[model samples]
Target: MRLRAVRISRSPLLPLFLLISTALALWPAAPSTARPASCEPSVPYESGTDGYHTFRIPAALQVPDGPLLAFAEGRRDSAADDGDIDLVLRRSLDGGCTWQPLHVVADAGEDTVGNPAPVIDPDSGDVVLVTCRTIGGATKRQVVAGAVAGSVRRVYVQRSTDDGLSWSPQRDITASVKAADWRWYAVGPGHAVALRHGPHRGRLLVPANHSAGPTARSGAHSIVSDDGGLTWRVGYLSPGGDEPLALNESTLTELPDGRVYINSRDHDRTTEGSRADAYSADGGLSLSVPFRPQPMIEGPVVQGSVLQVRGLTGDEPLLYSGPSDPGERFRMRVRASGDGGLSWRPVWTVSEDRAGYSDLVQTGGGTVGLLYETGQRTYHDTIRFTRLPWVWRLLPELTVSQGEVSGSAR
Candidate 1:
């Protein structure tokens, strides 16, 4: 699938220029030398029920003890009730080469559970997992069927101190929202990221979007907790405006310079296009108006994730992965950004022939690892991994360096 280009009006360039200038001025200065390649490939882990299908959605989190945790949703069949959706998790201890057995972190009984987002809190050093659950089935008649089936959706939080070995009881974080809107369908948290530095260091910021009720318009909201995940303050990114143009699967990345950037699916794009980008000056408390779209190699879809490479050259390349469809076929492709997200270069294809979500992490040895779903014609999508050397993109530059520098210089 090909991403359509967004029109850039000459009027907005001045403000954008000033914003970029201010951001750069506040950024910490670093050595003029470019970052060395730090990503390498490793083996992937795979696991799931034999017959029932599973899909790894959103992004995956890398914990301290070497295990990578991914939140996956499973489906018995398409005919099954929508309320049957459940959240399952898998881990890869030895990089991504192999995976552990399926662990049902949250399951749908009379309620629905999906959209699992995992993050490792630096302050507590614990892995926190959040997912949205709907109490009632999602059908026209179900809304009129009964109070139980038409209940609202909510966001639940769980933490794992010892990697993915165990988890705390699910805690509710949707009490501040409207009761009916917080029902099973539209109420709940989306993706979250912890502050890496500064006074609010270690606090968690979760992006909650509107998904409850039939007539609700989706907007971006956030919850902040000063004491790790113990307490939260809820508010909207853009107060009293049409919900900021965004969808469910969004990502937050803290740059080396201390600014937090958010990339979200642009549901407001009327024509075909790729994802949209936003920024948070006050550590995700609020976001600027959505920026113009970037040209993505893949066509537009609702969910994707983007991560900033800590030590990369040419504008700190960002890795983005999401579903790309061209007509009837669906595939997953990864793209690289040289000048941030203003432009992109195609990197690799995670899945050339399947339907799933993917996550990327920079390993200790400077390799980039990807966790995604595999298995065609099967309902259960097992986690698959692939590693690429950090030097993959730098190979061309290295070749020139070898010709210019002598052995004594090395």
Candidate 2:
């Protein structure tokens, strides 16, 4: 796949400083050094060739080996080709202290590989990688001037039996199902979560979307596979509302009470650009009509990720990490929830510098690992990693089990 250089226009709501300031005022003040740990940000070692650069997005996973596996989209300098945006993987073995190198997992054959969502299947211990592939580059014209291009963009899934070392052949998901229009790009197998401890246990649920095309409405869709992504059944969620609620980049977690909660990115919401909340039940297959949005400390509207942390004392707490757009600058925020997703307590700031499109994973030792783009700008940025103590972002209800130490050095 060739890499295409499309200049994505800045969001119309680019001046977000006032919005961020207002949101910050609503947020609770930072506590006076409560839970401390080694809090040093490490620069990610860039992998891949010089000509081929990879930009990390909001997709990553953590394995028991202490390495945080991340997927990035690689591309060349030119904007003519979209096929060069291949999917590559990297690992941070020393607990996000340092990263190894980039491992090319999947390369798009004359297509663009993007929106990688990685998850670890508890039952099989296999790393499941799902990404979107654009066969001809549907949105290239939107990026480039006077360029009329179209492609068959479909989501594909690959499994790695040996952690991030090897992967199986890519399988196209929407092969049988007919799309609404040829100009429509159906991307994202967003975040795949294997149901744990419930009637839907062992099932893998993937959220996808068909962007607005020449003929169809852009809305959210979901696919479920009982047998670990080999076969899937497509379905719609929260459809036929007053306005189009295009849900994408969803994060799913099974609560301790056997309830499945999905926090999705709402593109067409009224207030929040990045809206999140819980779905009805049954892994988003049967969702409640007109889902309500959760009240997050407002910032720039961008995609985020969530993880359920099992405390040392067997307490299950939730952690959410995302880029908070403050109008002018973007920062990463970490929030905690003790009672599911109903309420949240603000935690430490993940990135003091500019950041965008973040993903989070809870390490086996209870540490939270973050993969996010760190730079002043949005698309063209560097991916950085950082780890915080499980209690770094403390909630009033939860106790700090581990001692806090300042990891000030990178």
lDDT of each: 0.55, 0.60
Residue 290 displacement (Å), model 2: 4.4
Candidate 1, lDDT over the whole model: 0.55
Candidate 2, run of 10 with poorest lDDT: 397-406
TM-score of 2: 0.77
Reference-based TM-score, model 1? 0.73
Candidate 1's residue-wise lDDT over 282-393, tens digit each? Answer: 7767765453454464554546667776654435566676656643224656677656566665454444556455666664334466655545753124555555433334
Instruction: Quote each prediction's TM-score.
Output: 0.73, 0.77
> Which segments of candidate 2 are over 4 A away from where they belong?
1-40, 45-50, 78-83, 140-151, 176-191, 212-217, 288-290, 377-380, 397-410
Predictions: Cα RMSD each: 10.5, 10.6
In model 1, the Cα lDDT at residue 131 comes to 72
Compared with the true structure, the alpha-carbon lDDT of candidate 2 equals: 0.60
Q: lDDT per residue, candidate 2, 250-319, as tens digits?
A: 6666677656666766755554545656554666567653445676645555666777765444455777
